[model samples]
Target: MKDLYARHRAVLPDWLALYYDEPIELTHGEGRHVWDAAGRRYLDFFGGILTTMTAHALPDVTKAVAEQAGRIIHSSTLYLNRPMVDLAERIAALSGIPDARVFFTTSGTEANDTALLLATAHRRSNQILAMRNSYHGRSFTTVGITGNQSWSPTSLSPLQTLYVHGGVRSRGPYAALDDAEFTAACVADLRDMLGQSRGGVAALIAEPVQGVGGFTSPPDGLYAAFREVLAEHGILWIADEVQTGWGRTGDHFWGWQAHAAAGPPDLLTFAKGIGNGMSIGGVVGRAEIMNSLDANSISTFGGSPVTMAAGLANLSYLLEHDLQGNARRVGGLLIERLRAICAQLPVVREVRGRGLMIGIELVRPGTDEAYPQAAAAVLEAAREGGLLIGKGGGHSTSVLRVAPPLSLTVAEAEEGAAILERALRSV
Candidate 1:
């Protein structure tokens, strides 16, 4: 492991971060558990950064990928493809957008980049509004829109992005306010920002829950209130559901539905769990907006048959198994258990999130100061206890992230929670 880690550091970019002081190379996974190279098994709580939407080594998705690969795999968008169209049809129907059109991509970054392209072309403006402490992706355009300075690599961008408030509910200028007042204050801030900006702003792209910002989100209907203001100015709404889509949030099929008073957003970008780690992603939007571009565009590897097959099988399994309902039932228990455990611990500042996606924010014993070191220690401790987890935050990584596969069982949830309790206590 040490030799491989040294080789990785020598070959990979410095920015490609790895977890733990002594990184473990994962050998394989099954269900919600994974084995490292040394044959140590662990209950996987992070789900490969929430990309494994269903289960690891799911037979349905694996068989589909194998079968599809055996037949054909390299055909691009120039030719008609059945699996791509099939998955697109399913997603378009599920997407809540009227007259929806789907454009496939290889990652969340490309999907979001496509969304930005469509919005800018449709509205003829390069100005965009993004939430504070939000993370989009790694692309230049995404980096510019991302409000989290830690993840963003550069300030150079093609679009003029305006950072907005209301993404993080537990921390901010309006944190002290009640839910209703908080929502109103965020809406007022949005309206004021729009009022000050030049006319014809293209769109506002936001994550229903800020994933890389430690699973943080605004109060319910906050985006709906912001939607009202955006609609008055003809600005489009683009929901980035990369990490929160496909019922992971339990309460809703899509994270944006929590703010559904204004109906669905004009455009939606999704990736992560959809393909179950097969590298599938896409943007769905109204036809008018999607067709605004005058020139043609194509993705060489996006929507290939093999990946689309994996997506179809994975999605079918998720729905047929009622994994979303399972998440609600099991996740409720897990969160309650953690809250009770953390109530006595001063290092735990807060436990926030919904469904399978949960975050435990760490702070100094009696103060609000972010304790990133404690979060790192807890993560290492969790791994040592036969459980694997992740950490993230806007405050230099002070939040522990837990997002196992949607198919996680009650027993598994309880076990993971127990392991987490021990880890937290150790920290």
Candidate 2:
């Protein structure tokens, strides 16, 4: 293991960070559990950062991928692809955007890149609005719109990016405001930004629940409120659902449903969980905006037969079994249990997030300051107690994230919560 770690360090880029003080090489997984290279088992609460939506090694998805692989795999966009068409049709129907059209990509970065292209081309402007503490992706175009300074490596960008208020509900200047006032303040801020803009803003892209920003979220109607203003100015609203899509939130199939009052966004970008780790990402938008590109564009591996088959199977299983309902029941119990435990832990600041996407922010005892070291200590202790979770936040990376697969059993939720409780106590 030491030699393998040394080799990984030597070969991999330093920016690609691995978790834990002693990183474990995951060998195999089943359902909600995984075994490390040394054969130690753990309840997988993070699900590879919430990519495995249904479960690890799900039989349906596995069979689908294997069957497709046996037949054929690669087919570029120039050719006719049956599986891609089927999946695209399904996504378009699911997508709330009017006259929606789906375009496939292999990663969230490319998906957001496509959305930027559609928005800029449709609106004929390069100005963009993004929420504070929000993360889109790491690509050159996506990074420019990302609000998180930690994730964004460069300031040079083609677009004139404008930072907006309201992704973090519990911190910042609007933290003390009530939900109604907070929504109003953010909308007013947006109105003011639009009034001062030099060019027509192409779009306002946001995460319904900021994923890499530690699962932070605003009140339900914040975007609905923003939508009212954006529509008046012909600015498009894009929901980056890479982390918040596919019924993970339990209450809604898409995170945008929380703000359904104003109708769906003009564009919705999805990745992460849909392919169940098969590398599928795409954008769903109105046909007019999606077809705005005059020149041809194609993703070489975007909708490979194998990945599309996996995605179709995974999505079908999720809906047929009502994993969204499972998320609600099990996630509710888990959050209640964690909140009770956190109430007693002084170092734990707040427990937040909807359904399976949960976050526990650590802070200095009796103070509001972020306690990053406490978060690190808890992460190490959690691993020792035979559980795996993730950590992230816009402020100091002080939040512990717990987003298990949608099919997580109540028993598994209880077990993971118990282990996390012990880890926190030790911290």
Clashing pairs in 1: none
lDDT of 2 by residue, 1-80 (tens): 88899999999999999998888999999999999999999999999988999999999999999999999988788889
Q: Using lDDT as the measure, which candidate wins?
A: 1
Q: Can you give the TM-score per candidate against the true fold?
A: 0.99, 0.99
Instruction: Tell me model 1's lDDT, rounded to 2 decimals.
Output: 0.94
Clashing pairs in 2: none
* Error in Å for residue 243 of model 1: 0.5
- Candidate 2: C-alpha RMSD to true structure equals 0.8
In candidate 1, where is summed lDDT lowest over 10 consecutive residues?
191-200
Q: Per-residue error at 212 for model 1, in Å? A: 0.4
Instruction: List the candidate 1 regions with Cα displacement exceeding 4 Å.
Output: none
The sequence of per-residue lDDT tens digits that candidate 1 reaches over residues 146-210 is 99999988889999999989999989899999999999999988988988898689999999999
